[model samples]
Every structure is written in C-alpha cells, then in structure tokens.
Target: MSQTESTALADVSALRADLDLVDAEIRALVGRRRELSREIQRIRQASGGTRTDLTREMRVISPYTEAYGRQGTAIAMALLEICRGTGAPPR
Candidate 1:
C-alpha cells in the first residue's frame, strides 16, 4: 500500500506492455520468415530440385546475426531446423 510499491507495480505493468508488443512483432516476423521459406520451396521445386540451400540460408541470416555479435552459421542452422518443422524444404 506504499507509494513506492505502487510505483514499482506500475513500472512492471509498463514493462509487460512493452514486452507484449515485442512478442507480437516477433510472431509477425516469424510468420514472414515461414512464408519466405514456402516461397523458396516453390522456387526450388519449379527448378526441378529439392532441398533448401544452406548457402542461401547463410546469406539471408548472416547480416542479421552479425549485428547481434553472434555466429551467422549457427543462426542459419537454427533457422533450418525451424523451417523444417514448419514444413519448409530441408537444406
């Protein structure tokens, strides 16, 4: 019932609101990534080939991961797993 306690609760609520927004954005981006993977699969199928291209995955993920100071290849590998789970063609 203290003012300090109420202030802390308000701050927590604000942080949760921000986090919810971020979660929505993350979900949207993931959906877009899945859509792109489907398009990639279609493109490969039309070219009479199968299997996702690892190099293409690397190319797409590298810059994004690099900005996070992480290994791009590792990020690509993780995405490959996610893509497979979503029914995208395997690399």
Candidate 2:
C-alpha cells in the first residue's frame, strides 16, 4: 500500500483499539452499577419499600437525556433494565 493509505489504516486501527478499551470500561462500570442497584433494591425491600422508584429514575434519566437527547433516554432505559433488582440496575 502507499504510505498515505498505510497511515490511514494505522489511524483506523488505533481508533478501533481505543473504542475497544472504552467498551471494556463501560462494561465494568455497568457491572458495578448493577451491583450497587441490587444492593439498594435489597435494602429497600427489607424496609418494606418498593424496589423501583419512578421519580428517582426520572432524575437519573435527565442528565443522560441532556447529554444524548433521545438516544440518551434510550440508553438510560436500557441501563435501568439491566441493573434493576433481579434483572439489571436502577437509578
């Protein structure tokens, strides 16, 4: 390949590696969030409260929505689904 083509390929490879690293970090963070959410769910259930609270969830979704617009809202909802009580996480 020409030098320019090789350089572009190298840049793309580097960017893809960076994206892989980011994906791993996101997975770890989501796992941590899931653990924390489940703990909160346990505590709340023990205290006779509901496991999921919509008001608090709205608060959690707001910043994500602000950052990603509609996409953020969808992302936040997906996170919530995966982190809640027996399923995924929470707010």
Which tens-of-lDDT digit does each residue in 1-91 have in candidate 1? Answer: 9999999999999999999999999868766877777787888889997757767766777776777556765766676667645545445
Per-residue lDDT over 31-75 for candidate 2, one digit per residue giving the tens place of the 0 to 100 score: 899889989999999999999989999999999999999999999
Give the least accurate 10-residue stretch of model 2, judged by summed lDDT. Answer: 82-91
TM-score of each: 0.70, 0.92
Superposed Cα RMSD, model 2: 3.3
Q: What does the lDDT come to for candidate 2?
A: 0.91
**Whole-model Cα lDDT of every candidate shown, in order:** 0.75, 0.91
lDDT of predicted model 1: 0.75
Clashes of each: 0, 6
Off by over 4 Å in 1: 70-76, 85-91
Which candidate has the top score in TM-score? 2
